[model samples]
Target: RREWSFTLPAIVHAGTLWLMTLLVASELDWQIALGIIGETGLGRGSWNEIAWGLVPAAMLAAVGAWRTWPVTSHAQAYRGLAGSGLAVYLVLWVVLVNLVSSGDPWPLPYLPLLNPLDVAIGLVLLVLARDLLAYRELRPAVPHLWPIAGAVLFLWLNAILARSLHHYAGLPLDLPAMVQSTLAQATFSIAWTVTGLVLMVAASRLRQRLLWMVAAGLLVVVVVKLFLIDLSGRDTLERIVSFVGVGLLLLLAGYLSPMPPAEDKPTGEDAA
Candidate 1:
């Protein structure tokens, strides 16, 4: 069942967190270790921090496991606990950011605590939120493709307009700066365009024909930017061709593929 699947991942995540804690302790002194942990803002620094952070995490894991128990169905409890864990994590992130940014020394040597792990945690929370949202039947009826499409258009247009205005004013844009700006713009444009194309393909009601339109428009704009760049003839064209080619491939894939169906409902049949 889907709920069981969710539960397993949650358990794995909690275990991973505990394992990470052990590793941290082994690598650092107690004062530094406690500082790093407290700086994470999952809980306040005191006897209560461990009680709050680890206890809730453990409880959520237990609830998830219970969802799989044959005698007792704890799906609702699992959902509530998981949602609470996510909220706690988000609040901690905000508090930690503000605390760190205010020029306070972390209890540790300011270890890079915020990394891919945070992203992984955020993603897991998003998954939990999606499930809870769906359970309440509050899922969006309309696909979210257009908003992404609009963002892509806005960024692309703004970049082009800025470049044009700079040129008209005869402002001396340095070569390195120009390349950096162009690359950044191209990166965001390609990313959003790909997302839009994917959403268009996946949503049944979305017009597949429009995928090509968006692709073509993006291609034209990128091509124009490349041409306007002051690079040597062959190198400029090659760079342009390479990026455009990849973008086109992604667009083609999105246009041709259909969206996957929503996940199946979890059956409460698995035993813990």
Candidate 2:
């Protein structure tokens, strides 16, 4: 225990791992900025650069994943080592943004949010969240929050998709455009409602009061947004459909999912 408690070996290991990770990440950033693999197309030199950059990243991630496993009692020390490596791997997206561009019209159909880079980053977050955040003995509150994070990410994607569609359709930024966009944006509202309903059902199945409350919170947000924002276009067909659709979904949710029971607190003797 003494050896594991921020001792010299642990400190040295953490520092070394972080330093190596930073170095590799910096190299990858340079490669991306130089457009080793970009719109121009791939070449042997590009492949070499990509291979060099990704190989190090993969190695670091492997080391982090291996160290993160609770195979021993020194979970805290091990987590530090794991985080040093994994943190860089997770944040590589941020480091590689703003790559030099030709400044020509955007060739991609989707916005930056839906680009391959962003998609890859989202996937990485989902893949790493369970390992990095879910350990009941180490951190109880964390496991409950992944759902919220996922919900936020899902909502963001839906919104960006709606925006991209509006752009692709060449909708002008005006009142009529707003009316036209009501249907497109209503899709996001529907998605939000569905996400809440799913969460509610999951909460009921898992019998988790916290999760049920989270689901309720999401539903409340949808309701507020519907009344405050969506109501502006009350005369629009999209708004009518939204109201009817959401109401029906809520009714179905009420029938299918009930609130989870609160967890019983330990009595004084039991706690002792």
Give the number of the best model, judged by TM-score.
2
RMSD of each: 14.5, 7.1
lDDT of 1 at 87: 40
TM-score of each: 0.33, 0.62
Report lDDT (CA) for all predictions. 0.43, 0.58
lDDT of 2 by residue, 181-244 (tens): 6765576678778888998999899997787787788788888878877887645888888888
Highest lDDT model number: 2
Cα lDDT for residue 145, candidate 1: 37
Clashes of each: 2, 0
Clash pairs detected, candidate 1: 68-272, 202-259
